[model samples]
Target: MASNIPKFRFLTAAQVRRLHGTLIANAQPTQPALLESAVQSPLNIKYYNNEQNLFQLAASLPEKIMKNHAYQDGNKRTALVAADMFLKINGYKLQETPLQTGNVSQDLENAHVAVCTNAWTAEELGRFYEQSAKAIEEWTPEILAYRNEATEY
Candidate 1:
């Protein structure tokens, strides 16, 4: 079903490549098909194929990216960053407060492992994303920069 909500942003393959170069030391996909699959995950009908539910969108990245093995390495890192970036572009962010506990990197690591291994229920990967994603009223500056760059291409 189409959503009545306002439009949302999604990352392109080129943007993912740029992120890979900066954060993972590799800019190219080892398996181009897998990279495309991972990049297009949020649009899968099982994930609702719309902008109505942010959780569905946020939940799509780690599993596909981790399992797809798109790049030579750093798939887990890319999954985390991609999920966070997707959310930020759509007006949500992974926010942490002083009262929250546990190591975020560890949490993300555990979540990604659970996603790949199909033990997500035990690891509560949903909780990790749910706890972190907070919606805001304005577009993030990074997303604006991305919009500008996307237009230049």
Candidate 2:
């Protein structure tokens, strides 16, 4: 079945640079190769022309960004933020409680280590995204407003 989620607009290299600059303190500048990979990862997914679902797309994005080492530092942080933004744009969100946030952090660290050690497959990372995120049935007015505002810029 087709996913209910909307198609995603991948972050541009300029946008990634802006996000990194804004989010990281004294951040190391992004390399051209890293920026290209960051933009390409989602574009590849967007045109995969396969039967992949939205959760799979959401999950793969962070994994691709993180594993590709898209920044001199803060790859994990960037991956998480990019994935979250992708999900939000597609009408989903990661529903994390305080406890879940801790778990997610630990999971992210483990995933990083696994990727570094060549012990994790992209499929595994995609599964993690699917497990952590859920489709939103009803958005609160506040959340809707926030999403609207976020997309406006």
Candidate 3:
């Protein structure tokens, strides 16, 4: 039944840009989500399908959207929100975290490990963009378990 839920499909890289534009328009300077959609890319969908590994997918997100000095603050937080939303829509019981934490880079690193196990790395994550979805049709169940058990709210 969980699988029956229609996926929240994100179509094009341009759409992600639009999402970022919306966030920037709606938020104040310090608020996260200001430039979130810019980090989006079609590669994310390809990796999610191929790896069936949310952590790798999450880790790959920042490289796609974040630019040095692009946002004054909240870029990582915005990425986290986007990743959390992505996981929830795909039937994953995601662990919750304090929104807009001060330690975003560490948290993002942790998020990557939780999803990809030892396989999570920026270098490997880079490959997802070019890979075929058929590559990971049969993944181990352990790979499905998010490493950090999500907290019950």
Best by TM-score: 1
CA lDDT of each prediction against the hidden true structure: 0.67, 0.61, 0.40
- Candidate 2 pairs with clashing backbones: none
Candidate 2, residue 84: how far the Cα is off, in Å: 1.8
Error of 1 at 112 (Å): 1.3
Root-mean-square deviation of each candidate, in angstroms? 4.9, 4.8, 11.9
Top model by lDDT, which number? 1
Backbone clash numbers for all candidates listed: 0, 0, 3
Worst 10 residues of 3 by lDDT: 144-153
Worst 10 residues of 1 by lDDT: 93-102
Worst 10 residues of 2 by lDDT: 144-153
- At residue 137, candidate 1 shows an lDDT of 62
